[model samples]
Target: MNILFVLLPLGLVLLAIAVIAFFWAVGNGQYDDLDSPAWRILLDDESKPPKDPKDSP
Candidate 1:
């Protein structure tokens, strides 16, 4: 039908766009360091309690 002509080209364009995006992401180092973040989050940042005004007596 007439809709096939339009839908087929539209789908092809979308697929081409997705392929370009995937390649671009791979080339830009976006997928790098996937594991480093998990290890970095295990760090501890404990804060000391505030000194009370009466503790200095």
Candidate 2:
């Protein structure tokens, strides 16, 4: 029974911290481009040429 007092407050504090972090992330535009990152991984990066094995010093 005594543990409930400590556990309850700890749980509430953790929940509050999680909510604050979520709001901070959203305010910082963290979720604005969710799709682009996923699609970007599937695309090939052609800007840089592949390094040649013989070019190593």
Candidate 3:
């Protein structure tokens, strides 16, 4: 029963720290720009070799 006092407050403090980090990420625009990356992945990138190449054995 005595351990609950210390452990409970420690757990609450850790939870509060996690909440602060989540809010910091939200305020810093970390969630912006979701779709372009998916479409960009489908687009043909010039740096990579062509898919239907004769050299492939």
- RMSD in Å for all candidates: 4.6, 3.2, 4.1
Best by lDDT: 2
lDDT of candidate 2 over 1-36, digit per residue (tens): 999999999999999999999999999999998899
Quality of model 1 by C-alpha lDDT: 0.90
> Model 2: residues >4 Å from true position, as ranges?
47-57
Q: Which tens-of-lDDT digit does each residue in 7-39 have in candidate 1? A: 999999999999999999999998987998888
Which regions of candidate 3 are displaced past 4 Å? Answer: 48-57
TM-score for all models, in order of appearance: 0.65, 0.80, 0.65
Candidate 1 regions exceeding 4 Å error are: 39-43, 48-57
Which candidate tops TM-score? 2
Ranking by lDDT: 2, 3, 1
lDDT-better candidate, 1 vs 2:
2
lDDT of 3 by residue, 1-57 (tens): 999999999999999999999999999988788789889989986876668898666
